[model samples]
Target: MPKVSKWLRRWSLQLRWMFRYFLQWRLRHISDRQLVIGVSVLLGLGVGLVASFLLFTTRWISSLLAETPFGWLSSLYFIFPIIGILLVRTYVRFWFQGKFQKGMAYVLYGISKRQGNFEGYHRYAHVLTSAVTVGLGGSAGLEAPTVLTGASWGGFFARLFRLDSAYRVILAACGAAAGIAAVFGTPIGGVVFALEVLMANVHANFIVPLLISATASTLISRMLVEHELLTPREGLPAFDYVHLPFLVLLGILCGLIAAYFMWMSKQMTQWELREKKNGNRLFWEELFLLGALILFLPPLYGEGFEWLDAMINHHEMAYLQRSWWGHWLPAEWGIALLMFLVLMLKPLATWLTISSGGNGGAFAPTLFLGGTTGYLMAYVANHVLHFPVELPATMFTLIGMAATMAAYFHAPLTAIFMIAELSGGYHYFVPLMLITAIAYATKVIIQPVSAIQAAAQKIGAYLPADKDKAILNNISIKHVLERDCVPVPYEGSLRDLVDAIARSRRNIFPVVDKDGYLKGIILLDDVRSIIFKPALYDKVAIAELVHAPPAVVDIHESMEEVMEKFDATGAWNLPVVDEGRYRGFLSKSNILSVYRKRLRWQIEHFG
Candidate 1:
């Protein structure tokens, strides 16, 4: 064993030396921009391979239930999901150290708060957890786990190369793009998703690496995976201008449904936050509820992509046979009613799956809901409503997917490109754009925050729309605090204050007691008149001159709140107090100076 350990250490050192030599040679030949492009391509290819493996493994496990060695066990398939959830819960409790995180909200938190730094285990944990959960029919999507795996690898690469924070974030985003691109074979969609959902600002220089990474990942996935989410099939319908009015109505309807999804998601989040229900009790309750839901809505099992495909391809009856209601209801009504149930229950199912200790994300569920809503709308309009012009159900299905995605994520471009690539062409681009825009607009009108933003807010991670707030949120109050201000004794006369001023170069002075509690502040301007008159300075009391500040800043206040205080007080500086003790002074100039430096750093790195 000692010999093997020695041999392994020797080989590791040799590999590190070789990598260092290669890096030196590459640095001499490659520009910084070229290096980023090269790394992006490699990162994308790596992410694509991992994503493809996850997809293949998930599909294999999903089909495992049907191929059970004993036929009788198939009747107990629902119990398997409970096992999956328990497995995930066990992993989270032991392996993750009780810090189980899932979904794009966590990714946003990492980007906005952690400087894109993710733990090394994240590269593989999500892949394993999500595969087991979704594969065993936990009713969640695999896309989120895939993206997190990709982003973790991206952060890993950035650390390996010792890249700066800006590059670290960009690489993380590149990984996310590669994961999405690999899943659907849509490089453009992946690129837009990274820009619209992950990144706060866009630059021409940033686009090159993103595009290269997405394309490389797509190529790798195409080589490895046999099927994509949107593989074009025969008899696929195109967009029809005659269905414009129906498309408009579908957009509004999708928007309302998306609002419901967001609301339910928020409610579930609140429920999960209840202190008493967060442990084993909550897990078992959610598990039982999820089991009941999947029993009746069999289509809710796993990611529901198969069901979505069945709907879009006009194979509703064949797929509906799996449902209990399929035999009793008429063909058209069965499809519509089943779709309606899936549409409404999808959000609840997703909540149950995630809240019950399963590992997955909302990406697939949102698409599923959109598809269901679109299919039901077109089916009912044509069969039951008897419209003069037949609505294209397939086209509506595709558009519905995009519209709901746009509203849920607040990303119209990503949605438009996602469906466009899935269709294998730009045939439905016009309708995609039209419907996504209306849906996003309508949803924003009803619910100001996107689903992702709402989740982010719960964790105290602010994702601001404007550039200024984005930078400010990243800058903590401690980073900008000025501790150089000289403190004046609360009981000291003006004589001591004058002498302290001579020792210090500051204009503002804080009146602090012997125990370090702040009493008030004395501005240098207010004491200027008595400084020249020594007799008057000795006679004047510091307590008489000290005045209460317009406002005091807490040490833990957010930068936005600090800025608001400065604005409200019309003061250039404010005293920082924590628990009635004086800490330091916070000046507008210092914050602006730090803000400028950060802005420059962003411009340099991003450009």
Candidate 2:
């Protein structure tokens, strides 16, 4: 009876072992390229579908709310200005509670820290509040919410997969790219934008997956929704050789415009800070005042979306052609003057939205504001200056979009690519590049860090100067390698070799001669072959069965270099030796575990 019980137990153990063997075999063959491609495809599909649905949903809600009998609820647009104020206040109030202070800042933090984890509930709250604020007519765009949603999803998935810090950051960037692509229907723009804005560094290793995901998302979004949020300009003439001087002038004007916006945004935040300190006003109360201001400003009251629609359709309004409210005021200077004013105010609107706690993205608003400014400027140059340059207002608008975005976000390449994607060609590359260069240089001269970087610094989170090299070198094989030594004699039988290898936490074992000198390594395959041919198993020594010249690494070498060596040799496990003696072994699982843990720590603490 006891023998029968032992036999049953042995059979169960054998079954478990075989199951594990099959699982490992399956995992061993799964290539990293295949995993990256598969993940990219899935992410792209999800981002595309979600972005398109959201775009349509936002549009439908805005239209329905405007047309309803309660369409006076459209007066709710007045509330957006205040809502924007409230959004900024909420972010500021909660700034010290975590490492990430704002949505964009959080994304950047995740990338720099290599841990993208954010408080899901808190992030959801921010999104809901912002959405309500913007939907009711907050003078903000929807891109911010979209980006936050995508970033949160990426962070969640990275954690779930137990990805390393580098991969986690890359995935988060991919998420942002996917969201942008889906929302704008510009895959190339999204890809470049992610690299420029979210990732501090760009490497070839990350480009493939990022681009693939962005393209997939864009395609998916197109299938779901047919409308383009920001349509391309129509009826624009190609650049002429005579337009070179005018283009340079336009670039200079864009730089100045970008600088003005940056200044206004900074001032608005400073004003809010002062008001909060002196008046002791709560966020909601300040929001009410902001709403009242909007209600009083006749042009701003019900005209926000109207103006946006006009800009989109290339229709210039008489009022916009004549006036400047604060800096360029009075309504008589014509289209050129209005353009300058709008250019100056674009940053103000963006700042207001962020400050008021309005839920929306600066991306779309920046484009809208920049385009309007450019149109006005171009109109002035042609009609007022009589430069004989027929440069379209749309072209100026596009340039303004790129310039303003480049200045504030510090992503010139992204700005250029995004404009090209939106405009549908590289026809304006020279002008766009020139404008981007000017804007970037101007911003750098005035402010060394971008708003996103500023927000990160406020929360005590900043990218290390040599972070990549430090992380790679810091991960040493000595820190993660398995030290449990279970050596097999060269003269040992095949059965003995199999048992010894099985007892260890690996499939490979080092074989030693009688004098403790290292012979070679015997892998599971060699054991299996010997087992299949019973004659060999019975007659051959372990030395005969072992594979010669085992791949080995020193105990003190960096795990990164060890990994590279393993990759080059296609070895899953390598023996760790010190001087002339074999210490133990290292496997991919050990390195992977260390990386996963490091990433988790960064996310939980920094994100």
Please give the CA lDDT of all the candidate structures.
Answer: 0.83, 0.64
Please, what are the lDDT tens digits per residue for candidate 2 over residues 1-607? 9999999999999998996785566458754334555667777787676676666665554565564332245355565455444554566458634333455666655555435665565334444555455555565666666676676666666665445555666676777889888877788888887766676455566688888889998888888776443454464457666766766665565556656665677677788788888987655654665565444332332214455445545665544432224234443354455555445554555555556555565666556556665666667766776666576666676777787778777778888888787666478888788877887787788777876677766654554334443355547666776867578888888767756765877566788777766777877765665566656655777767777644678887765568788888887678887775777788777776777777565445333
Question: Residues 436-471, candidate 1, lDDT per residue (tens digit)?
Answer: 999999999999889888888777665523557667
lDDT of 1: 0.83
RMSD of each: 3.5, 15.3
Error of 1 at 222 (Å): 2.6
Best by TM-score: 1
Report the Cα lDDT for residue 176, model 1.
87
The best candidate in terms of lDDT: 1
TM-score of each: 0.88, 0.65
Worst 10 residues of 1 by lDDT: 68-77
Clashing pairs in 1: none
